[model samples]
Target: MRKNTIRPTDIKLHQKSRVLEVAFEDGSRFSLPCEYLRVYSPSAEVRGHGPGQEVLQVGKENVNITNIEPVGTYAVCLHFDDGHSTGIYSWDWLYHLGTDFDELWAQYLERLEKAGHKRKPAPAAG
Candidate 1:
């Protein structure tokens, strides 16, 4: 089965808001939070050596993307302010993440809760 590879038509990083806006060739657009990308990084450090070895990333609520560099023609290397830059995000992976945002995010929160890890608390309202 030969699957068609769809590439992003545009990628915009909102540094202040810490969101990465990606639009694909199929006209699908997604605004993914930097925290989501950092925590779900495909790097070995985050993904671990194999199945069931995944490390739960905590305290990434305030993580910022310092850079986004194209990795050949198939992926992009995201450099996070937290010093994680090994993840090579493939087009297909990114697309799947975007489309599966809600489900994945809920799973992440559940994992964090089970591990007794908490993200940084939001600032109190003035």
Candidate 2:
């Protein structure tokens, strides 16, 4: 087996809305929405061992992570106001997310559309 390593080139925080802009040394960058990152989490709550096991996440249109706690030196645990913090996302996972962002995002939109759902922008805080 080959060993894989990833180093984050830069991470930008959108203080106003809680978005994280992550860029890698491989010229891959993605503006990861807080909500999107929360829902598509690799945790068992989102992903499963096989197909048809994925639970379509709902009511997460406005979820935002308030904190990110590191796990060991490879993964990070994201804490959201919605009380979701089970997923430990690794650097390799983050890299894949950033690299396939466009395609993955498009697929998400397509699924939502197929399900007759629409993406509403996150509401402004009062």
Clashes of each: 0, 0
Q: Which digits, one per residue and each the tens of the lDDT, describe model 1 over residues 1-126?
A: 118878999999998888999999999999999999998999999999999989999889888899999999999999999999999999998998899999999999999999998878644434
Q: State how far residue 114 of model 2 sits from its true place (Å).
A: 1.9
In candidate 1, clashing pairs total 0
Choose the strongest candidate by lDDT: 1
Lowest summed lDDT across 10 adjacent residues in model 2 is found at: 1-10
Relative to the true structure, how large is the alpha-carbon lDDT of every model?
0.91, 0.79
- Please state the error at residue 96 of candidate 2 in Å: 0.7
TM-score of 1: 0.93
The ten-residue window of minimal lDDT in model 1 covers 117-126
Q: Candidate 1: what lDDT? A: 0.91
Model 2 / residue 63 / CA error / Å: 1.0
TM-score of 2: 0.84
Residues 1-126 of candidate 2 have per-residue lDDT tens digits of 116857677777674676878887777787898777886788888887678897777667877787888888777888887998988888888887877878888888888888888888777766
Model 2: runs farther than 4 Å from truth?
1-3, 124-126
